[model samples]
Target: MWKEAAAGASPDLEFRAPVDAAALAEAERRLGRSLPGQLTALLKETNGVADGYGTDIVWSLDRVVEHNLQFWSPDTFPGLYMPFDPLLFFGDNGGGDQFAFVLTPERPDIFVWDHENDSRLWAARELKDYLHRSLLGEGDWYR
Candidate 1:
């Protein structure tokens, strides 16, 4: 059902194999936060989403770790990402901006951290809605 929902929205719709507990655990450790239930379930189903039709990718576990460790640090590279923000980046908009879960909430909410404007704003109420909208390119997010 989840795969169908995601694939139905994506243009390329490439899916990956399920990942193991250790991989998931490592991802959490790398991100330093527990993923939301829905996101955890989704990761177990497909470690990531690769849209073959030229779009953003819902990062794989390794990619997640790599991207986080790369960006979520102090002045290591050129970007707006900061170490203090309690966000676990899960996807990229293929334009340097990212999507992540805001960890402050009891149930993590989705937010778009704009790389260009250096602003963080609410994007989706939950992971599912975020994925669906992202895959379908809804909401005119560039505004």
Candidate 2:
């Protein structure tokens, strides 16, 4: 399931997950944001991001990266931007009204829309750093 979702199909570049109403509500309350209708629908159908290698399965608020080496180049493989775990961001922000989650087969991170700069890449290192920052509330550290 993870592999299929990660490297599967779709022009929209989105992963679906079953909607957990309670979880969604709780996340919204925590993050203080409202989710968009389209995103809500997507979540109702899909569960979470597909974990590459078919081992790590990120749930509602978690995130996973799928790296495609075929098209990856030094310039493209290790993207500069980093993607966030929707579960973490949305859960923290309550729930965003806009659709923010995105996955790329060419990059080693997830791409998300930056309200300030439009969109940016969230590398795996950044993801780890963000996770650690959120957990420790200290400096940055990539896993």
Candidate 3:
């Protein structure tokens, strides 16, 4: 289903090995929150997804853990932008902008975090919508 979602948009998308349940559990433990169910299912099918140009459309489990940890840490940005505690960043646009899921209220919608101005805006309805848009469209499709 995960592959089909992207393949429906582009056949050239790349994929990495699937992550095991244990690893996902560890990641959740580290983040102090569970990953969205759709995302977890996708990770179980493939650890990550990338475009033909090697851009990470969906980051691997390890990168997911590390990136979110950094974003959640106060020392990482420290007044440069809004607190990242409410977001769980997953991938990037290869131009410093990133994609994430809102965790505070636990919503399924996907949003783009503009790097320059630090604005958070709705991008897609859910993971599948995000995949189709991000895979079929160019770098700034969300905008």
Best by lDDT: 3
Mind sharing the TM-score for model 3? 0.98
TM-scores across all candidates? 0.82, 0.33, 0.98
Error of 2 at 41 (Å): 1.4
Error of 1 at 53 (Å): 2.1
lDDT of 1: 0.74
**Residue-by-residue lDDT tens digits, candidate 1, 43-135:** 889878867655545788787778767666766654444553577778878877788876665556788888776788888878778777787
What tens digits encode model 2's per-residue C-alpha lDDT throughout 1-143? Answer: 33233343322233554758887676556545444443354455565433222212223542311221212224553555343333222212112211233332322242333434435434233333322332333222111
> Any runs in candidate 3 off by more than 4 Å, and if so which?
none
lDDT of 3 by residue, 22-110 (tens): 99999999999999998999999999999989999999999999999988998999889999899999988899999999998999999
Ordering by lDDT: 3, 1, 2
lDDT of each: 0.74, 0.36, 0.92
Residue 71 error for model 1, in Å? Answer: 2.5
Best by TM-score: 3
Off by over 4 Å in 2: 1-17, 51-59, 62-143
Order by TM-score, highest first? 3, 1, 2
**What is residue 80's positional error in candidate 2, in angstroms?**
14
